[model samples]
Target: MSIGVEEAYETAGMILFHNFDIRAVTLGVNLKDLIHPEAEKMCAAVEERLTRLGTRLVRQAQAVSGELGVPIINKRISITPAAWLIEPCPSPQAPLLLAQAINRAALAADVDFVGGFGALMHKASTQADRRLLESLPEALSRTQRLCAFANLASTSAGMNMDAVNQVARLLKEMAAASPDALACAKFVAFANAPEDNPFMAGAFHGPGEADACLNVGISGPGVVRAVVDKYPDCDLTMLSEIIRRTVFKITRAGEMVGRKLASLLGVSFGVVDISLAPTTAIGDSVGMILHGMGLERPGAPGTTAALALLIDAVKRGGAFASGNVGGLSGTFIPVSEDTAMIEAVECGALSLEKLEAMTAVCSVGLDMFAVPGDTPAHALAGIIADELAIGMVNNKTTGVRVIPAPGRQPGDCVDFGGLLGKAPVMRVSRFSGSNFVGRGGRMPAPIGALRN
Candidate 1:
């Protein structure tokens, strides 16, 4: 993966000028083999594995980042779904204990975050799944670095209204338990969620993966926005081509760094998620990219079309650059994380409905948005159901990470600071959807699921 002199210079320019960097280097460690009938023994095994591997991951990741001159922002670990590991434990408190153990390991290893405190019950819930799900409010509120997710729907299995209803209620409880509802940020509800995602709150090592693997999430929102700024007068077709070419170079650089890091760590190199994840840094924004493409602001009249074009070009470029592109490799529209998106919400240009419409094309549905705490659980369920239905019918991965900020009304602001950024709380509808969401049953797979 040697680079020519010109290519090296261009890569350096991207890092030095634009905000091109590897957003996350996530090591997926399977803990299924460490499962024990005794929760204490299981916790010990899991902690030992994570502490050992996580230390090495942090050490070597820094070495690679220094060597390649690429900034790796986050070093994380994702484990086998917690539900499977806790299946054999008889103790009702096992989930909280496991979360504490994982958090201890994360602190010892010095990683930014550890994912996989979650369950997969898109169609049906097991007793273990219920236990894990029930403990999320306490487990997440008590732990610092542990992220959780629940997959409640899929293209083949359809939507689980029962799970959706339960999660909605739990989200409210989680909000009430944690300050500013920050615990809700650590949890996501997914439909058709990916197994090898390197992002937080949604990353988990799937049952089918190898015992150990290293995955990367590369973000270049600034780089793409810079390229878009260069061609002000170009037509949309040519603009797409330009963005695609730029993303190809970004993906190549990510693949080089990821492969080198994996080799150094003696683990299998997994995929490079070429998602345009934005940050609070000035000029590093997916929303600004739309603005550069002639939109006055995100959520403007042509915002959805603009996002679709941006994401399509990004995926095509990533696919052309590497065969190992996986995860939610598209544009992220987190309202808090992106400066322009936050401005849009504050200015009333972006509504909750418009964001939901945008998520049909973007990755990670309804991400990092804040709402009023008094919003009913039924309304939350309605929102989750609507978002998941898009994924189920469209057969793409989608997720929701909404925060119900206690005592914060619409138009007020909540700042979690650093990476999570500041959010201007948006208004949710006062109307209720309890009658529709209360009828607990599967939504049945869409007609497209019959493809066989």
Candidate 2:
């Protein structure tokens, strides 16, 4: 499958001018075998395995990027969920020790982030799960490269309100423990979290996955926005077609790079996550793409409908381009990571409620946004529950990566710098959801979960 001259030229143009890049090439390394009864021994084993694999991942990704002329912006690692590994450890602080080991491995390998430092408590929490939850604030705050996620809900098992409530409190503690709540940016709460998602904070080497595999995340919000801008007068249907074609090209490029990289590394090729992930850079925003579709701005009237169209079109195109399309293969609307979304929040065009609404149609949920420090933990749980409920009923993946920025109020800004970007503290409802959130038990799965 060689690239044609015309296709090659177009791809070059998109790369040169439209901020198109391979956002991440995450090597999912299963560390379930590294679990040992002794915490020290287990930590050494985990570090060794990750360092060996992560080094290969970065080298292969760099080689592939240089050969293809596409920028592979991040080389990351995702290991088996920490809960599984921590269950065998004797020490109370085993989770933190493991997190430190993971961070050391990432730094040694020169990877950007290493994920899977949390648990899956959708149905019930085990003793190890509890310990991992308890250790999250300290572990995340202390580690730079370690990212964490907890699957608090799923369509089959239902929402774990107890786990959700616990995480809410931990999130506040995590913010207070760190400067600017930076650790909160490394954590995410998910419903139906995917096993092979290459994107950070939620990615993990699921128990079902192979020992080692490579997954690629391709991002091109700027490219999509450019195409939409080129056809300004087109109808909605025409606009969708244009976006679909553009995404097809992008996904094909991703598939080529992923296959080549995996081959070079002697690992199985997993999937190409064709998510239009945006950055803080100008013209590289999903919100700007929405604005280009004539919504006046993101969070304006008809924004959800426009986003739904874009999401569906991108998925369709990506699926056609590669059968390996998986993960959250849709538009990402992270508030802080996208310049246009940040601007919208700053100017009051985008509200927390509206962003929640957009998440119902987009890939992830309530991502990278901040709220007032004094906002109750139960309120954060309420927000997470609402977002996950959408995924539960719709049978799709949804997540929350919001931060309760310390000492920040509505209209205030917290700067995270670099790709984490800056966020304006958005206002939450003054009303309380404590009584509702206090009713801690499993929220039953939707009727759709009975499909099997």
| Per-model CA lDDT versus the true structure | 0.94, 0.92
lDDT of 2 at 340: 88
* Candidate 2 wrongly placed segments (more than 4 Å): 1-7
Cα lDDT over the full model 1: 0.94
Query: TM-score of model 1 relative to the true fold?
Result: 0.98
**Which residue segments of model 1 deviate by more than 4 Å?**
1-9
Please name the candidate that would achieve the greatest lDDT relative to the true structure.
Answer: 1
lDDT of 1 by residue, 1-452 (tens): 88799988877878898889999999999999988889999999999999999999999999999998889989999999999999999998899999999999999999989999999999999999999999999999999999999999999999999999999999999999998899998999999999999999799999879989999999999999999999999998999999999999889888998899999988899999998999999999999999999999898999999999999999989999999999889788999999999999999999999999999998779999999988989999999999999999999999999998888999898899999999899999888889999998999999999999
lDDT of 2 at 438: 95
lDDT for position 57 in model 1: 96
lDDT (10s digit) by residue, model 2, range 48-135 = 9999989998888888999988899999999899999989777997998899999999999999999998899999899999899889
Question: Candidate 2 deviates by what RMSD?
Answer: 1.3
